[model samples]
Target: MTIALRRRLLAEFTGTALLVTAVVGSGIMATTLSPDDVGLQLLENSVATAFALGALILIFGPVSGAHLNPVVSVADWFLGRSAGTGLTGRDLAGYVAAQTLGAIGGSILANLMFDLAAVDFAAKDRAAGHLWLGEVVATTGLILLIFALARSGRAPVAPAAVGAYIGAAYWFTSSTSFANPAVTIGRAFTDTFAGISPASVPGFVAAQLVGLAVGICLLTALHPDAGTAADQVVAPTGERDPVLGHRP
Candidate 1:
C-alpha cells in the first residue's frame, strides 16, 4: 500500500480502537460505580462516549477522516460513486476491516481492564420492533449530522456537534444510540451494559443501513450542490475532498 493509504488505515484502526475503549470501558466503570442505578450508569457511559468520540475525531480527522464507523465510510463511497473521487473500493475495504478489528480489540481490552473475561458474549437481548426503530432513528440522526456538516462546509464543528448529538440521543433513543455497526459488533463481544446480543446484531445492522440510505437521500435533496464530504464526522481539518477529502 502507498504511504498515504497506510497512514489513513492506521488512523482508522487506532481511532476506532480508542473510541470503543471509551465506550465499553466507561460502561464497565459506570456499572461498578452505580450498581443499582441504571440511569446513572447510562449517564456516565454516554458522557464518556461523547467526549471520547469528539476527541478521537479531532485527533485523527486530519490523518484519515476518522470515520471510526463502517457505515460512515460506506456512505462516503456511495456518495462519491458517481464521480469516483472519494474513497476507492480498496480504501473502503481496508477502512472497514481495520475498524472492525479495532472494535473487537477494544472490547477485549476493556474487558481485561475490568478483570472480566475477554470475549464474553453479551446477554442483553435488545430485540423488539420499537428498539429496532430506535436504532433506525439513532443511526439516521448520526448520518445526517455527519454528512450535513460536510455538505454545509461546517466540518470543523463536527466533533462537538456530533458528540453533543450522540449524548442527547442516548437519552432520547431507546437503544441508547448504538448507531455504529462496528460498535454494535464490538459490544456483542462483551456482556456489559453497552452490549447487544449477537443474534440482534443483524437486525441492528440492517436498521443502520436503512438509516444510512435515508440520510443520504435527505442530504442529496437538502444540498444538491454539495460536492464533497468531510474526513471526520464533525471536524475535518486540511483539504476537503469532492465527497470526502483526497488529502494524502
Candidate 2:
C-alpha cells in the first residue's frame, strides 16, 4: 500500500485509458472522415495511435513503467524476477487490472463521445490463420523492440522506437497490429472500424501470448544477462526521451 505503488497503478490506468482513447477514437474519426478511402483511414488511425503512445510513454514512463499493456507488465516481471528489479506479483495483478479496466473505460468513452452506443459489440470478424499469424508477428516484434533497447542500454529511445515500430507494423502486418490483449479486449466493445469481434478476441489473445513466449525465448538467447532496469520498457524519470531526430 505504498504511495509509489498507488501512483504506478494510477499512471498505468490513466496512460492506458488515453492510449486506447486515441486508438478507438481516431478509428471512429477516420471512418467518419474518410469513408471511402480505406487506406487513408488506416493511415490516420495509425499515426494518431503512434504519436499518442509515444507521448504517453514519455509522460508516464517514470511511473509504473507506462506498461499500458498487460503482456509488457507480465514480461517485465518474469524477466526481472531473478534480478529483483521488476514488478512484484502483487504489482503485476494491480497493473493488469488497472490496464484492463482502463481499456474498457476508454472504449466506452470513445463510443459515447461519438454518439454511439456505450456497449455495442463489434461486428468486424477478424478470424483466420493468416490474420493470427500477423498478430503473432506483431506482438513478437513489439516485445523484441522493447527488451532489445533495454539490453543495449538504449532504453531512452524506446518511446520513439516503439511508436515507430507500431506505426510501421500497422502497414506490414495483415492484422493491422492489434498486438495487445488489453487493446483487443477493449476494441471488442465498439462496432467501429478499429473494433474486433468478441468471438475473435480469444484467438487473438492466444496468439499474442504465443508471441510473448517466443519473444521471451529470443531475448534470453540474444541477451541472457540483460539488465533489470525499469527503462527496459518505459522511459525512466527525468530523462528527455531523446525526441527530435536523436534516434539510434
Candidate 3:
C-alpha cells in the first residue's frame, strides 16, 4: 500500500521480466545460429544468462533488492531479512504474481519472436535421472555460492557472483542449472530449444528447493564473518542479505 512497497514489487517484476527476456531471446537466437549443435546453443544460453543477471543487478540493486526468486524472498523472510524498502503482505503477493506472469509472458515473447516456442520434451539426449542430478547439484551450488557471498558482505556486487555460478553450473550440472523456478516457468512458455516440459517443472522446482535447504544447513556450520561486528544486522536494508541476497 505504501509507495516503497509498490516500488519494491515493481522492481521484482522488472527484474524477472528482464531475466526472462534474456533467456528466451537467447534461446531463440541459439536455435537459429547453432541449429546443428544443442551444446553450443546451451553455451550461448549460459553466457547470456550470466551477463543479463549481472547487468540487471547493477541496474536494480538500489530498488526492491532485486529478489527475482521465491526462495530468495523466503530466505530473507525467514532470516528476518526483509529488505524494508517497505514491504507488506499485499506487496509481496503482488511481486510474486508479477514475477510469475513476467516469466510466462517472456516465453510467449520469445516464441513469437523466432518460433522458439516449440518444446520437444521427448528429445532424449540424456535420461531423466541424469537431468534430476543436474538439478540437484546445480541448485545446491547456486545456493551455497549465494550463502557464501552474502555472509561475506560481498552481495553488493552479487550479480557477478550469481552469474558466474550459473554459467559454470551450466557446464557442470546435468540440467544446465535452471535453478530459479520463476525462470523455469518462463522458459516453459517458450516451448523452444530452451523450454522444459510441463512434467519436468514440478520435479525441478522440488529438487531445487531441496538443494537450497541443504545449502542453508551447511551455512550454519561455518562461523560468522570475522569482519562484521557481532551485532551486525545483515537483514532488511542494513548492509547486505544472508538468506536471500546473491553472490558477487
Candidate 4:
C-alpha cells in the first residue's frame, strides 16, 4: 500500500477505537455512575460523545478524512465527492471493517463496565413515521452541519459537531440519532443502555440513508461546488481541498 493509504487506514483504526470508547464508555459510566439522576446521565453521555468525536477529528482529519460514520462517506461518495483521492471499494471495505470492530470494542467495554446483560430491544419505539421522520431530519441536519463545516474550513471540529448532533438528537429527535450504519450495527452486539435491536436495524439504517440523500440534495442546491463534484473530492497534499480546507 502507498504511504497515504497506510496513513488513512491507521487513522481510521485509531479514530474508530476512540469514537466507540467515548460513546460506549460514557454510556456505561452514565448508567452506573449517575443512574440516580437521569438528566445528569444524559448530560455525561452527550458531553463525552461530543469530545470523543471532536478529538478524533482533530487527530485524523488530515490523514483519513476522519469519516467515522459510513453514512457521511456514502453521502459524499454518491454525490460524486470521490473524484480523486476518494474512497475506492478497497478503502471503503477497510473502513467499514475497522469502524465495526472499533464500535464492538466500545460496546464490549461499556458492557464490561456496566455489567450489562441484554436490551429490552426498543423496536416498537422506532418503527413509524415519527421515528423515520426523526431519522431523516436528524441525519439531514447532521450531514448538513458536517458538509457546511467542511466547506467553511473547519474540519478540526467536525467530530464535535457530529458528536453534539448525536448527543442532542437523543432528546430532540424521536429516533435518538442513529446517524451511522456501522454504529447502529455495533450497538446491537451489546445488551446495554446503548443497545438497539437487530430487528429495528433495517428501518433505522434506511431512514439514516434517506436523511443523508436528502441532506446531499439540499447541500447540492446550497453549495453548487460540492454538488457538481468539483470541491472536497480528495485529500490535499499541496494545499487544502477546496471544500474542506487543509489548515490547522
Candidate 5:
C-alpha cells in the first residue's frame, strides 16, 4: 500500500474508533447519571454523540473524508465510480474492514472503561418491523443530507449539519438512528443503553442498504450531476489537488 493510502486507513480506523467510543462511553455515563429516566439518558447520549461526531469530522475530514461509517463509504464509492473521484474498490474494502474492527474495539474499550467485562455481547433485542422502518428512514435521510451538502457547494457546514440531523433523528426516528452498519455491529458488543442485539443486525443492515438505494435515487433526481461532486461528500479531503481544488 502507498504511504498516503495507509495514512488514510489509519485515520479511518482511529476516527471510527473514537467516534464509537464517544457513543458507547457516553451511553454508559448517561445511564449512570440518569438511571431513573430513560428520556434523560437518551438526551445525554444523543447530545454527546452529535458533538463527538462533528468534532471527529473536523479532526479527520482532511484524511479519508472521515467517513467513519461503512454505508457512507459505500455510497461514496458507488456515487463516484463514474466520476473517478471517490474511493476505489480496494479502498472501499479496506475502509469497511477498518471501520468494523475499529467499532468492535471501541465497544470493548468502552466496556473496559466502565469496569465491565470487555467482551460482553449485548442482549438488547431490537427486532421489530417498526424499528426496521426507522432504520431505513434514518439511513436514507443521512445519505441525502451528506450528499446534498456536497452537491450544493455547502460542504463546509457538513460537520454541524450532519451532527444536528443525527441529534434530531435520535428523537424523531423509532430506532434512534443507528444508521451505520459498523456502529450497529459494535453496539452489539455491549448491553448498555446504546447497544443492539446481535440477532437484529442483519435486519438493520438490510434496511440500511435499502435506504442507501432510495437515497441515491432521490439524490440523483435532485442533482443529476451529483456524481461529479461525490468526492466532497461529508467533506473534501487532503487528497485533492492543491492547485485545482479537486482530485485530478
Candidate 6:
C-alpha cells in the first residue's frame, strides 16, 4: 500500500476509535452520574457526544475527510466515482474495515475504562419496528445534511452542524440516531447505556442502508451536480498531494 493511503487509513481508524470512545465512554459515565434518571443520563450523553464529535471532525477533517461513518465513506465513493475525486474502491474497503475495527476497539476500551468486562455483548433488545424506522429517518437526515453542506459550499461548518444534528436527533429519533453501521456493531459489544443487542443489529443496518439509498436519491434531486463536490463531503481537505493523496 502507498504511504498516503496508509496514512488515511490510520487516520480513519484512530478518528473512528476516538469517536466511539466518546460515545460509549460518555454513555457509561452518564449512567453512572445519573443513575436515577434516564432523561438526565441521555442529556449528559448527548452533550458529550455532540461536543466530542465536532472536535474530532476538526482534528481529523484535513485527512480522510474525517468520515468516521461507513455510510458517509460509501456515499463519497458513489458520488465521486464519475468525477474521480473521492475514495477509490480500495480506499472504501480499507476505510470500512478500519472504521469497523476501530469501533470494536473503542467499545472494548470503553468497557475496560469502566472496570467492566471486555466484550460484554450487549443484551439490550431493540427490535421494535418504530426503532428501525427511527434509524432510517436519522440516517437519511444525516447523509442528506452532510452532502448538502458540501454542495452548498458550507463544508467548513459541517463539524458543528453534524454534531448538532446528532445531538438533536438523540431526542427526536427513537433510536437515538446510531445512524452508523460500524457504531451499531461496536455498541453491541457493550451492555451499557449506549449499547444495542447483537440480535437487533441486522434490522438497524438494513434500515440504515435503505436510508443511504434514499438520501442519495434526495441529494441528486436537490443538487443534480452534487457528485462534483464529493471530495468535499463532511469537510473540505483541499486537493490531494500527488504523492500522498492528502493535503500538504
At residue 16, candidate 5 shows an lDDT of 86
Evaluated against the true structure, the overall lDDT of model 3 is 0.65
Q: Looking at model 4, which ten-residue stretch has the lowest summed lDDT?
A: 230-239
lDDT of 3 by residue, 1-248 (tens): 11266666676777887888888789778878999998899988889988998787766655666767765554444443233422345655776787787677666665666754333232323237777778878876765566566667766657787778878888888788888778877776655667776767878888778876765566556633321311111121323345667421
Which ranges in model 1 have alpha carbons more than 4 Å from their true place? 1-3, 230-234, 237-248
What's the TM for model 6?
A: 0.94
- Ranking, TM-score, top scorer first: 5, 6, 2, 1, 4, 3
Q: What is the overall TM-score of model 2 with all chains considered together?
A: 0.92
Q: Model 4, residue 1: what's the lDDT?
A: 22
Q: For candidate 4, what is the TM-score?
A: 0.80
Question: Rank order by lDDT, top first?
Answer: 6, 5, 2, 1, 4, 3
Q: lDDT, candidate 4, residue 180?
A: 80
Better of 4 and 5 by lDDT: 5
Clashing pairs in 6: none
Which residue pairs come into collision in candidate 5? none
Model 2: which residue pairs collide? Answer: none
lDDT of 5: 0.90
Query: Which regions in candidate 2 have their CA more than 4 angstroms from the true location?
Result: 1-3, 237-248
The alpha-carbon RMSD values of the candidates against the true structure, listed in the order shown, are 3.8, 4.6, 6.3, 4.7, 2.3, 2.8
Report clashes for each candidate as comma-separated counts.
8, 0, 5, 1, 0, 0
Model 3 residue pairs with clashes = 117-190, 117-191, 118-191, 119-191, 158-247
Q: Residues 1-248, candidate 2: write the lDDT tens digits.
A: 12378788899889988888899999999999999999999999999999999999988886667889988887888888888867789999999999998898899999999999999999999989999999999999998888888777888888899899999999999999988899899999999989999999999999999988898899888878654764356565333335653223
Q: Write the per-residue lDDT of candidate 4 for residues 14-126, one digit (tens) a residue.
A: 77766766776787778889879977887888788877776777667656777777777666556654445346667777777777776666666656656664333323334
Q: Report residue 118 deviation for candidate 2 (angstroms).
A: 1.4
Error of 2 at 31 (Å): 1.0
**Tens-digit lDDT track of model 1 for 104-137:** 9899889999999989999989878888888889
